[model samples]
Target chain A: MGFDWAVIHDNLPFLMRGLWNSVQLAAITVVLSFPLGCIVALGRISRRRWLRYPATMLVHALRSNPLILIVFWFFFLVPILTGRPVGDFASVLAAFVVFFSAYFAEIVRSGIQSVRRGQLEAALSTGLTYAQAMRFIVLPQALRSMTPSLATECVIVFQGTTIAYVVGMREFLHTTFLVTERTMRPVELYLFAALVYFVVCLAGSIFARRLEGKAGIPR
Target chain B: MSDPLVSIRNLGLRYGTFRALEDVSADFSRGTCIVICGPSGSGKSSLLRCINRLEEFQDGDVVFDGASLRACRDLPRLRSEIGMVFQHFELYPHLSVLDNVTLAPRIAKGKPRQEAEETARRLLDRVGIGDQAGKFPGELSGGQQQRAAIARALALEPKLMLFDEPTSALDPEMIAEVLRVMRDLARNGMTMLVVTHEMAFAREVADEIVFMDKGRIVERAETARFFSAPTAPRAREFLDRILHRL
Candidate 1:
């Protein structure tokens, strides 16, 4: 296998475009999942059995399933059931959104639960409603504690965008594969793809560490 | 001529298989401090929590300023009127001291932000840590945190305040500052029921002191009389053990 700087240079713009699409998907998915995760967390922790049982079951089922299976189910199942063709990007995004949302919900639920019960009681005894206490007190603290886990989830979902290639939605890995097919240097192309994922995950880990420091996570 | 500000009758609280408090009954008149003292696991904290419905007692009645806590719909209003402080200064760590004190007032009492902030400022000053308003709970000393916890409780202007071993989490030096704040509240005629092992604070500030053992009130008397001459042997032994530690 030969190192072909020219081939790599030629594909850089297309790869960047694909990378941007992946990043956009991950970013929007993060924003979307956060509130959804919070709601799911609240539901799981609710006093009413009606709310808690179904929410817990949904989260448990999602968590137990593989990300690929989740993507396949949403992508294939939604179109079959609805009789409407959702766009490729939308299907991929929706699949990952649902997958990461359950993961993030577990993060949120544990974070909030890890906080002492006395804190919630204190908030309530002050006359705040359950929603008010959660909004003003519990969620803020839980978000702080859950930051590292949430960031890790973002990175996981970012890399999981590689799975979109399986569904034929051209992403970072898919773009690289196309270039490699033309260049015909499989080893070199795979190494370059690895490098891209490494740099992105490394950058995310560093950013998450900075956040942990700022939030005063105890050593 | 009027009902007590807080009343409990036949309260029996069970946590799973264990009964924390059982068949406990008490009445609290307005504007007096009631000190509850007991050995560890004696249902002192559980009793205080039951009054505010922080812990649900399976078979009992908690009437707070004439509202029944047994009814689910009335708990929020009842809880609003009855504030509680915990052993740990359960201040919201993410918020500033000002936000900690003001949040419930704004959210629960529906006070405007400005009014809440102003009230929070006043209460913070009353606790002698007004300068710490913008600081988070983690930044304050344990005593300051506990005092802020009290101020946070005060922000709602509760008709009754319950303290569940508030000073137990504090360092020796820190306990005094929190007790001073409690003393000040008592002086101003705040209606308070405290579960504490701080015998000095209890004796100095409490109008009535109730001693509990094994989920029941063993003795009840005025603070001086109870400390001077506890009628029950359990109360006497408990006081002796406490005095030995102090």
Candidate 2:
């Protein structure tokens, strides 16, 4: 009851396409969410209650809910709100960005706070406005310190992409599941999918750990 | 003859019901150096921070260079004329010494990079770390880093300078190097407020010495008089303990 190499062999191109879609989703999510996360982080760390409270609430709300609920929330809500049918991939991408940003905001806030308080004092005393100091002195330091953590978070987002398969978005895992349906080789297909995820995440974590050392920031 | 450069009046501050500073007041004149020295947890550093608006005081106000600091709408503009050097040498570790010095002037004042870099090099040279300008703060020794910090502050061409325990975080051997730069600044007529334990440097460089205890100025006198004969018993005890430890 073992082998069906032929099913995978025949579907390699299709599977690779799915893998590319997964990567593309992850990449676009990272690029969009990181900067959005930074803005939300600033609000989270802000002195103004107007900014802090809403940002805090958003972070808590998004983080507390499971990603699947978030996926469904946008998947259904977006089309109704826009008065049209938004596709699954776009809907999932929206959910992914929203979900990942909350985590990234936390990372950014921690990174900004990790900078010695005296550094900001020095910048302020130099007559730099808070915005300018944040732009030049504080952020450069914070970005350097938070690089490893940001990379690690991106890996999680990549792994989290598999959940999109539930919505039938045809990502790597979804594509593998399709092949399994055609071949009646559930064990082989699922095992191959797990191996692929393990390999990608393993490489990503290794890269992150090396970055933590080079960044000289003790985790 | 003219008004004092900085006049801090009835300044009061608290930290959640604890009185950190109570009705503290002082006047710093132009072209003079005042060294504030006291025991740890005393109000020396807090008072310095208040002048630059780093710490918000609960009561009273500071008139800096003829304007009331509390009412000053453009704080960045007000701050630009005041320089601060921290004990830890907060030289912006990610930036080179030259970039650290040039950053504020270029960004805040709209000074061109060429102009800012020129001023930075000259100040760094004056601080005696000119050759080390290309290195990051992490790459510099404590002495070199402190000097670079001084250069960074000086680049603003501030009307007043604040040094909060400038040598307190340095190694014993590194202390003299930073103190020497401070000495040079004082002699060259940079209006400064320095909080330090180095009584000898204070004696030589400070026009006046302000001794604080438990958030109040216990005594303010000519540097020579303060060291030889302090009016306040608390100040006398502090000087005795500090000088003996040194």
Candidate 3:
């Protein structure tokens, strides 16, 4: 009959492990997806139909659907392609990678477009090949301008990691669910999970805003 | 004018229904400074862009050095041999001025970093921005940025250079410094095709003045002769209007 905070105290270590898993998942996704997204951005902006069409379709498709649907789609899709029942973690990760890359691709493509056309013209007239010019000149300016957007995407990625819990991936929110079932104190555990998510995401949002302020200065 | 560097043979271009260049032809000779000047929509810039193949034509070709631009397979090589400076500086803002100049040589020509830096410094000094090499382009003034842009094009060690209204974007005070660098380049026998409104520079340095109007060459003559007695009424009226302001 008494409201007890003891369940959260007793399960701190287990909950921390869950948080650690979330951190690892977000970190891996950020690392894998940003670079992949840059390629997709280039492909989306490319003049060639072969590269542009698929890249544009993927970005639009992933952007329209909810994260959970993507998780389920890949959940079923990965097994069919791999010809084996891959782990739930793998499916969740594939979902996150595919989903977040579309967001990042949009960010990077805008950054690329923001650079003036004359910059590309100057680079081309120098006889540097198109790829070389993008690598040496355009990307350096674009990626710098993209820093704030990239940071915000990263924060979203961290928040979105909670979706992995739907697949029974045992991430932070799922660990709270596990503790509530055992202790029969769902109210305390759910509130604790919410507080944790809010605190962490707020800090990330603050950092991204600071980057945006500084990015305004032409560097 | 006997030895030609770029020969435009019946070059024609159109944008939708509007013809940008109509059977435009000119032979730019080696070691000579040719100034192409006309009003805002005379296809002067289009003719310049065609030589570098930046603007492709539906009919005819640009023959640079010896090869025809339309038939050439190695575009990068051809472009490298011919340098172009835009109206805006278009310097790589992220790179230091030194790096901006050295980039083409180091990456495109495979020059060693040390060798490229040396040449970059020499050219930067020639353009009077020797001490500004370590600075980013955003840190420099408009005149300094344009000079750096000129040096960047020169770093390719190109046989021919194209100036597409290089000083048009500069403040009036800054124009003279850029024109000075260009004059120095001309004096050093760097064959250049200049598109500018600077009649003083044209009179002082141009071997010949090419006047275009409505996508056709209306008049072509020696700079002194063009200035004194332009045969075309359009060319005469253009000179009168532009010179009246000065």
Specify the poorest-scoring 10-residue window by lDDT in model 1 chain A. A210-219
lDDT of 1 by residue, B34-146 (tens): 99988899999888878877776899888778777787585677677777888888888777889888887787778899999998999999999999999988888999999
Model 1: how far is B208 from its true place, Å?
Answer: 1.8
In candidate 2, what are the lDDT values of residues A109-209, reduced to their tens digit? 99999998988999999999999989998998899999999989989999999989889998999999888888788887788778889999999999999
User: Compared with the true structure, what per-residue lDDT tens digits does model 3 show for residues B51-166?
Assistant: 88888799988888889899988778888998999998899988999999999999999999999999999999999999999999989999999999999999999999999999
DockQ, Cα level, model 2: 0.62
lDDT (10s digit) by residue, model 2, range B128-177: 98899898788889999999998888999999999999998889999999
How much is A147 displaced in model 3, in angstroms?
1.0
Off by over 4 Å in 1: A217-219
Candidate 2 off by > 4 Å: A217-219
How much lDDT does each candidate structure score? 0.85, 0.91, 0.92
Candidate ranking (lDDT, best to worst): 3, 2, 1
Ranking by DockQ: 2, 1, 3
Model 3 residue B130 distance off true place after TM-score fit, in angstroms? 0.9
Q: Residue B148 in candidate 3 has what lDDT?
A: 95
- Candidate 3 residues A1-219, lDDT tens each? 678898899999999999999999999999999989999999999999999999999999999999999999999899999999999888899899989999999999999998999899899899988898899989888888889889889889999999999889989999999998889999889999999999998899899999888774233
RMSD of each: 2.2, 1.6, 1.7
